[model samples]
Target: MQEILDRAKDCYDSGLPFVVYRKPNETDVFGVFQSNDELRSSKDFTEKGFVFAPFNDDNQVVLLQPDEVWEGKYQTEKSEAIKDINLDESGKEVHIELVKKGIQEIETGRLQKVVLSRKIQVRITKPPFKIFKTLLSKYPNAFAYFIHHPKVGTWCGATPETLVKVKDKKLKTMSLAATLPFIEDETPKWGNKEIEEQQMVSEYIGDKLAHTMERLEIDEAESVRAGNLWHLRSEVRGTMLPNLKVSEVVRALHPTPAVCGIPTDEAQKFIHKNENYKRTFYTGFLGELNLRSQGELSLFVNLRCMELQGDTASIFVGGGITEASDPESEWIETQNKSKTMLGIL
Candidate 1:
């Protein structure tokens, strides 16, 4: 464990590119370290290494080849200690207005739902390892990762949503949405807004995968907890077509209703027009693309993530908006989502 940590820190300190991650509910950690800093893009998604993709398809999808590899077990038996994180509310007014416009778009029959997001910069008092350690212990069910490269800088996350996982001809993915702060010993009473939002995502996923999968099955939505929030989630699984490629499945589901809106293209266009900021890889996907001879794939939707720079960190958070959304309440939802990363910081 000490040797792996030392190598990772050395790679980061020397400005080399690398990615170290642990999949959800997995004990072993795997790392892919680049020998030198160089920008590489995986356009066809055939890259046999770790990939860090962007929210928008227009941008280049960064890839880091596993020139050197490391693997070890990380203790998830207990959580690491965390210091209090100081966060100030920012961009509430702008986000609220954005949510209003999104609701209006839905009311006018333009979109059923649109996901909106914001970023808050908070001072960091510890190194990246400390934060990553806290994340690994805190969220055992999340795809926790720490990635750094000269081109993309540094981005780390504990994402709960799997973009897609392929083992041979078998394929599995998740449609997760709706958010409420988690309580200790009670079942979540999901409202209409939450139920509809989750259903929209599941339907969108099913429709998208209908062509590629030989058979599709979507289970009932269930309540799952991640960090300080509870989300309504459903699993969509099936067997792939005879010649279905992993890249095709990935591109088709890049921006699901969970991250974007019902009519994905239009909602994404509105987000680009009104958000007034680049999301980069915040709501994007990341993780191992192709591994070993069987060609297994595991990539996750980047949520509850932050970009680190100098002494401050940029934490990103967002929520899905529908006609039932209240501007003020949506604003509050974003705040609650932010605590997932903020609390561990």
Candidate 2:
């Protein structure tokens, strides 16, 4: 475990690019350290490297060349809450206003749903690797990673939503949305808004994949726990069409309704126009791409994530908004979502 992080630190110190990650429900940690410092882009998605995509595809899909690889078995140490997590909800009003606008868009039939997010920048009291250790330890079922590049800086996250996982022409992904504070031993009573919000994402994914897949199957939606919160989740799997380009499938689902909204382009326009800040790679997906031996692709949405710079950790949280959404409740949902990262901090 120490060796995996040690090599990552050495790579970062040399201003090179690397990604040290542990997949969900796995006991092994993996690292991809680029031998050079070149800032490479994977536009065609054929690159056999680590992919770091941005919310808007207009930005380059930064690829960390898989020059050196490391794998190790790791034991997770439970993260203890150290900081009094009083997040700066100063943007609460702005986020609520954005939610209101989304509702209006839905009411006027411009969009069926929209996912809006806000940032909370908090100071850190620990080193980057220490924080990553806590995060990697805390979420045993979340895809945890510490990725650094000279051009892209540093990003640490334990994402719950998966964009895609492809191997041998078989692909699997999930529609994950709607958040609530998890109460131990209690079944989450999901309301209509939450159910419909998740369903919209599932249907959107199914419809999109219909054209890209040879056969598709979607499971019933269920409640799943991701750290301190519960989310509505539905697994979707299919057989990819023979010779279908990986890039084509990724483009079909990059900004799914779970992250963007129904009528993706219109909601994306709303997000870009009203969010008032560059999301960068917050809601984007990142993971292993094109393992030479297995020809695999495992990617997860960049949720419950933060960008680390100096002593500050900029956390990103968001929720899906339908016509039935409440502004105050949405803000609180983000607050609950932020706690996932804040707890480790």
TM-score of each: 0.96, 0.97
Q: On a 0 to 100 scale, what is the lDDT of residue 212 in model 1?
A: 93
Candidate 2 per-residue lDDT over residues 1-345, each given as its tens digit:
789889998988889899999999999999999988899998787778889999996899999998888999888676676566776768888888889988998999999998888878889988999889988878889999999999988999998889999988999999888887889899999989998888889999999899999999999999998888899999998999998988888999989898899999999999999885789999999999885544589989988889999899998888888999999999998888888788888
The local lDDT score (0 to 100) that residue 251 gets in candidate 1 is 83
Candidate 2 lDDT at 278 equals 86
Pairs of colliding residues, candidate 1 = none
Cα lDDT of model 1 by residue, 231-327, tens digit = 9989888999988877899988989889989899999998999885899998899978675644688889998899999899999888899989999
Score candidate 2 by TM-score against the native: 0.97
Model 1, 296: alpha-carbon shift in Å? 1.8
Runs in model 1 lying further than 4 Å from the true structure: 80-87
Give the Cα error of residue 95 in candidate 2, in Å: 1.7
* Over 4 Å off, model 2: 81-84
lDDT of 2: 0.89
Deviation in angstroms for 10 in model 1? 0.8
lDDT of 1: 0.87
